[model samples]
Target: MGIKESDIKQDAACTPGLSNFFLKDHPDENKWADCVHCGMCLESCPTYELTSQEQHSPRGRVHLIKSVAEGKITVNEQFMDPVFACLDCRACTTACPAGVDVGGLIEEARGQIRQAIPLTGLKGMVSKFFLKGLFPHQNRLNSLGSILRFYQKSGMQKVVRKTKLIKIMPQHLVDMEAIMPEVNKPVRKKYKNQNVIKSKGKTRNEVSFLTGCVMDVMFSDINEATINVLTRNGNDVIIPNKQTCCGALHVHAGDRETGRKLAKQNIEAFNDSDKVIVNAAGCGYALKEYPELFREDPEWHEKAEKFAAKVEDISKYLYDTGYEKPKTELNTRITYHDACHLAHGQGVRQEPRDILLDIPGVEMVHMPNSDRCCGSAGIYNITNPEMASAVLDSKMENVPEDVDMISMGNPGCMLQMAMGVQKHGRNQKIVHTIQLLDWAYQKEDGKEGL
Candidate 1:
């Protein structure tokens, strides 16, 4: 049966005073038009695969977003539903022969939603608080991180997990809630260099780490590990004080003004660095996309391009930086979960895998659709919990069984994958790529690298 014409929702769009569709400085229309719409993407779509909904399919959403972008379709709740529903996993792109860059389109759709309509619901508001509270400020997020850590250390988190509170919530909500690891220590000082010694020669490379909001507050150890790996590999790592939130949550949530400001801040903050080493795949992806985000302003556009050029997913950076094959053999089998941002947004295909393969004792097995999202797209898991969980459920089944550990590129994926491990009552561990790398570098016995 064909999609019913009456089922489509249409409404007058609220185009924010800036509507230059052909701005080259803005989003790339060439990338947007690359979708040939073959049904191959549907098979890998978790949302489509989960419910078999046509609207959830990558091809289906592409047409809608394309329609809205060209002003061919009215912007309304109907259009936004499918746009927001996307996990932005880039699994579809992985399967796309054309390399359509669906993740970029999804982000454009999100920018449209932010400007066109007021997406207000309880869920949307909670997302608002997360953007307002959890992101923008490093200080408050650290405090929250400390509290979560206290809850974990105090056994409250364990007790809560044991209880049915999450189950009482929506399935998706429970699924998202199920994924957060009890918090560890927060990163207190912004510029604390541990035991890493910089190479004495003309510096192999220089990079400034954007200790992103969630990265600073929640999974800080990953930051430490990133610093260790980069410096140990003979690069001078800088954690710039001027860096704030990467504005990923802002851009997705429709707050373009704040998003723009944050983009400019980051660009100027790390203006001097040759490479902006972003350990978190999501942040790296979003940071690189800022050129599109600020296409409207020439000055910012120039800066955004400059900034975007410098941005590097740490895994890709390390691989490009000449990481020698591991000296210590880690006699373990493992799986690598590619974050959507890294795989789809940045076109980072083999670098992370190549890095993992270089670990001598470690055998990195590719999970089916390793590029599929783990269902934690910024606040997507928290706000649209049900759909996120459904996507996560797909990931759970796709992972290989009996893996010693799982490595992922982003903090959100790491936490979500760890949660998935616990949900299945399995003993597998989760670690950032850098953490395991650092461990393997220092550990005499390979077991501890995880």
Candidate 2:
């Protein structure tokens, strides 16, 4: 918490507003310059695939960043739109022969833009409230969750739905409300003054759980399932009381100042554990990339690197650590939706699918374009609902017919897919990979399976 004023430079030498947002150490010119402008990334890019526009493509976006760095173009809405429009999904990185870090470049550009021209109006207010106002503070996040829990449990949801009051709201808002998971008490409350949840049997490892902001607030059951699965796999899970949100949203939104603040707090919170486990793919991606946030600060950068090395997504960890094959049969057909952050960001494609296939009686169907963005690129779905929904329509269209469930590693994907299911009246359940594993472990017989 010893954040010095000089630690973050207010001004730097570059094209007017350019160098101020991006640190001298980053958006590495060499990285963007490596792009040979081959069109291979076009097919993999969701935005490009949807729009077929050059500006929305990865190579095009890289060109924009390169232009800004060279003083050819100012970082205005023209520049900002292409940069922010990117899913930061790293799909381009996978497709790039030159190995351009498109996601990193986009994030770095966003940092510059946010610092230079801070958002104003309703967007600014909401961004400020969540990025700086709520997520960085654990108490405030939980309080907001508590308020949500009240609305869900106090018959307000029923009243609103029954009275048709929701008709006055935006269609998306009403749709989101309908698919929203019933809020539960935050996982922090379940521990009851305890910091560590000891494994039931011979403990193979000691780890810290980053019960992320939205992961805990809306999908608390997933957090609980993650703990159960971790323990069942022979790990002592430590729920660090001081841990706040992973600040993925902050970083994604280009609020690196706030992201750096949260990174420092989490690095200290989970310092003692052998591993820092995350259930959500987006949080895992952000947590694993924390070192990038301190590119200019070598000392903290080293510490962050060490801290990030231990951050593992639950599916990857379970597959790596090995697990008992489920004896109970789930008896349901399922397809796996690769969360962008998991498949492209973390290079985790097979682990979650492999686990699902291992479960007895679960039919694993290959979902076409399963790795495509579900239109829930953090707040992209909210900020750009039309584009987000179009992407989602593609995702829903490809969802294999008659699949009873769709399993994913990220909570955002779960919510987005849930909304997709509700929109199309598919009646399919969207669940976490860890939740399925937890259910398999807890089931004593065929009578139980979500």
Candidate 3:
């Protein structure tokens, strides 16, 4: 029902040292008040499902944040765990009858942590490096990509494998490295002076493409497929060379200033295009929510709103544009895993599936709990390995036995699923939905797809 005065008194009494560390920032009270202590979100939360801890659930975390907001509790280590432990998959929001924005609240709470508490030691170092140093700078990120490509193609990887050097490294690191996709030459390199790519026929929609940091470096091929698929559907694609990373990872990790900086840069970069197409789910979610970053500044707020209005996930855009169904048949049984950001954050559920089912000879099987998080909540896999792996185990068990492929929209999901396939030694192919769509489209002309 509702929180009682007596229960609030009890909660205040239970948590000691409240005066020592006051919360300089907290999630909005109105948002926290939306939660009616309904346990409907429990089943949908990955951490709650694994540990069965009340504090790990959305409602419990809301209560904690509410207490902190009311000055009854402090923003300490104990409080940070409940807030950071959330996968931010937005599954709870999907399940909540009250429509409490759990993901937004968690992110806001994370922002509070970054502002008041601030991470230190290795976590702080790494966060500062990537959030500030790398992601916001396209040239530095591409250089790192080049180094990774060297590691992959310079025979160094072969030596590591042949010498059993991988044995010394953590299994997770080794597994992640093993499944690393061949790094294609960065899109900026391939399309050096090619900014605007005209449609094959009449141009239907002109859009700017966001080639995200990790997406461009590791899975550059996906960006290539995205461009091809858009042009195939009569979209004149504009590659904005100046557009930086969408600052999703930075925001998720609670670095608001950096996130906001990158948001401004992106808003400026894609200013000319009314339609900004993003294939990666995380990037799409962040780009669409850029307005949220500038809520307090009316001038930037209006600009951010206008910028976000142009953002669209590729599958959702394709389906909305009435994509042509491929005549070429790809005879295989496949299951679609909904990336949390694409399915829950962006509210894009059916478009990818609609595109998949439209393909000739493609059989779609319903995977149990297909919308559940695959434990790749941005950097959650690396930060919270045990919990991440536990959640991933639940996800992997839901895949159908005879499924030949697991198609999803996000790059993070693709990497996580690839890791799962490697761990279990399954013969399933993990690929992006657009990749598969591009393949089938190419098949019409007697070409094979990766």
Candidate 4:
């Protein structure tokens, strides 16, 4: 049923401390306390820009969350739609003058909603199969990747495409399949016997690498490139075997219990490592936010804070720690898209752009509203296709068509932007920022015939 004005008014009269959210990890009241109903975030919100609905706006959503805490609204379809529709891109938080954490509040509110009304039927089954059954387990992801590799290599993919059988699936999925990156053996599996990949020269730093679950499966090439770049620049990279998924997807999907479980596993997995290096922006941001998952537990929370402190995105890591600049010139005109998590979530805007600029013969074109959400907000394209498409459409308008390649940090953004390119009939190649650096180093090595 829809949230009625009278119902909200009636519930508002309830006791001050009472809450409609009965779950343990309900939305933190402190997050919304500073909102002040300011509309500063409205222009920054993609959904609000499209629908122009109050509930879809950041402050509006914050109001809804606050109302729930005040017993003015109950968790229902009325609450679920706006909350789930959110891209959680962290743009709103960036725009807020008061520095309100709309993303954190949305995630915590989702935790409450999931507990109050759990998913059932096909949606539940699929969600559970992927988030619970598949992600946290590395072997299963490898098996799935193997299957995909066979499909791509064994002529099944061509047959399905030629027969038009792929048209049976949703258009978005079909679009994604059309532009899907070739699946290869994960770096973790390739480097399983070897605990540490030694630096090319004298090692300057030793760091633990989180070869993320889906990242390793779908874009293992990028993972390989990241390691190559790290080692070439005098860093010995350590792959943590015990580490699994970073739990970003689970937390975004409102499965906080599973999110917490994965968080604990990762926290324990990388406990001994001094520095945790991540290539994927989503994974890095999720790793940094581990403390948020353990807010109620002091012991785990403290451990999580320490773990988070050591985590850094690969681009930022290389930039902060001086790396040898490639003498080889790439001569590639590339436009960089700021992955929302990398830019807004982690405040890592200039560091990556600076790294791109430092590359010899690489000309960087500025994408207008470069930090704008690309609608790939961690599988939002899969869940909310129409809005995602609209957001993608809006985002593509800002992408400079003149660039040879479109570079970004997150794999999800790469895939989503690939779809946008395909949908718009554009020819720009989608790539991770680290891949360009890797290519330059490879060229340098090739010139010397090393």
Candidate 5:
């Protein structure tokens, strides 16, 4: 369902948090005031570049947040329209030399609005039905992913793409319909409860794994490979079943209560573990950020800090472990797309690249502006198709010709990049970094292993 201006504008009494959506959490008196409005982000903003509309630009959105925060305006349906229009791509941040965290500011503002205004119509219906209903519940997401896999496997996707039937559907639906990946596995065969994939030699590290929601559903194999690679290199892998959603989708969407609830759950789950490992960049960024989410809760704030301290990106952990390079080299030409969370969010710029470099027979071509987002930010592609496609197009333009593969750490990015490749009528395989390692180690035909 789409959010109607009428529904948002009704003179409904606003809750404290709901009345002003951009004020409370993560409040930085100076940080909020740092937007100099230099307009430097305008050129780099995907939405602004695509639409050339002031309402869609970063500066415009920031102005809206400021206005809403100062009570200069009531955040009725039309008032929040610009805020909702933001993709949270973080491209604006990348472009902002002042280093204002637009992503965080916009997210907090959205949360405030969600609290104050009751979502109605199409947008509200979808959020309640999907995010609150389907995603948070792992089992349901698994089922939905399975159903989607069938569509991909049964060539329903191909039929839809060929007929362009979804073009008649909602724009968001058409985009989601266009950007599905080739699902290979339904579940990670191992890595379940008490199932430890121990390292071969003396274990150098003991780590807990977050077998993510969408990850467990759609691309379980990658998670499994991550486990195998970790163990083969001599590290004990632990999958803590208690770890729930990293509260990324929830937090990003402005559903803070549920996000905080899940945040507390994940924090307690990882508290006992020495090091918490996450394969998904988005999840990694969120998992390491529990402290900021629960800052207001004096009770859980300390726990949040401790949990945040132990979180590590899977690539960073693997790189630090000195995993030996696979000896057999396939001589494949590949490029890397840095997930925004891993790069800009955590300053994890080198670890993933270093891991890719360590692999044998892999020619790593550094794409121009590799650090820029591919525009698959969680729900951004679904909500903002035109800008997402614009960013994808910009991303694909940087891909070196003759590249056989493009690898990334985030699933959202992989799907978005794959869609970009398809739309351009080109054939380029997209895989996780671990996929390359997994295939390298397999003893099957034409197998390449150290």
Candidate 6:
């Protein structure tokens, strides 16, 4: 269940002075060289805020990672607990004056940890099934979507709920199920026959879209909305058939080998496109970080860097390239929640807000600490339910009850915030930012009888 002794010896010979991390993708030393133990990041971290423990703080985690490199610690359960407990939200990096890449270090450290102590038993089985077997295959994900569609459409879901059969699972999962969005046909399948969805008017830009594995399956409506907004705004959208999962989830789960494999596939898939647009914050962030996965390989590393340069989040793309403002008005009061990857990770704080404000009659209410993590660091809610719930509860306190909707850029944040809304008995609707813009455009078209 661990790395072989021979493999460890080889890694040691290659990376001399390294004691615990016997892997090619060990945490980058340069990422943490700027850390002065400033304690500035302590206030930004969610775990530190909740636990009030130094070990849970950003500075503490950096120290621990440095300790592992210096032969002061080993990759034991004690070390694993704190590292895995982190939300990997990247808020701390925003707060750090030295700009330490804590999220990158955590991901790389996780890559090392999984090699040293591989998961076994039930956890291992589930991780392998989802991360390896399910995510990378588009056909498999589409099949899962079909199954989910049947479960939700058939009377089985209702019967199970009414019989209290769902209570057999844990409470957090039940909570997630309670607020689960209805599954629809993914946009990839919907537009499969058409290679290029041309613009309504004169073509302004040609961009390829990444219809993500989870994003397409779980929240395909948003994906469809994204295509509509783009086409309506004069961008010819391209959906590359060969594009696979962005590997954010795999990397987050410490499966760096699979992460690199997936990265290579996407880099090749979108090689010809001038712009690669992503609607999901996590997927966009992961796409931009493809270069990190190929640091050791120079040729692929250069390709990854070129690929990463073209990857842009949808909101930023629209804002930067000049999206048309909707003419019609649909009066709705909404507050914006910053998806951790969108706000802190990508520094996309203002672009989405700017997009929201451009829609006529949309009143923007401000949420305090809107950039705080909603505990949906990929599958963190499923893995660490208790902490995720506590973090969600803390996040809900800042949401304005007067708003009609909670708008954000990421699908994971939408689900997590939806659970928060349901749990707290609030009635605010959770929506992607692009959906609002699309709705406004549709309303305008409807009014003009288009």
Instruction: Go through the candidates in order and give each one's C-alpha lDDT.
Output: 0.74, 0.84, 0.85, 0.91, 0.75, 0.91
lDDT of 3: 0.85
lDDT of 4: 0.91
**Residue range with the least summed lDDT across 10 consecutive positions in model 4:** 4-13
Per-model TM-score on C-alpha atoms:
0.85, 0.94, 0.93, 0.96, 0.87, 0.97
Tens digit of per-residue lDDT, candidate 1, span 161-236: 7886556776655655566655666543745553223543446777777878878777777887777777777787
Which clashing pairs does model 1 show?
25-295, 114-254, 172-385, 172-386, 329-361, 330-361
Write one digit per residue (lDDT tens) for candidate 4, span 325-387. 888888989999999999999999887788778779999999999999999999899999999
**Model 5: residues >4 Å from true position, as ranges?**
1-28, 94-97, 146-179, 182-189, 193-195, 443-450
For model 1, the local distance difference test gives 0.74
The root-mean-square deviation over C-alpha atoms between each candidate and the true structure, in angstroms, is 4.8, 4.3, 4.9, 2.9, 4.0, 2.2
Task: Quote the lDDT for 175 in model 4.
Answer: 94
lDDT of 3 at 76: 65
Error of 5 at 418 (Å): 0.6
| Clashes, model 4 | 0
Ranking by lDDT: 6, 4, 3, 2, 5, 1
Clashes within 3 Å, all models in order: 6, 0, 0, 0, 10, 0
Per-residue lDDT of candidate 3, residues 315-387 (tens digit): 9899888787899899989999999999989899999999999989899999989999999889898888888
Q: Write candidate 5's Cα lDDT for 93-115 as tens digits.
A: 77888888787777777776786
| Residue 325 displacement in candidate 2 (angstroms) | 1.5
With candidate 6 superimposed using the best TM-score fit, by how many Å does residue 28's alpha carbon deviate from the native? 1.0
Candidate 3 regions exceeding 4 Å error are: 1-25
Which model scores highest in TM-score?
6
For candidate 4, report its TM-score: 0.96
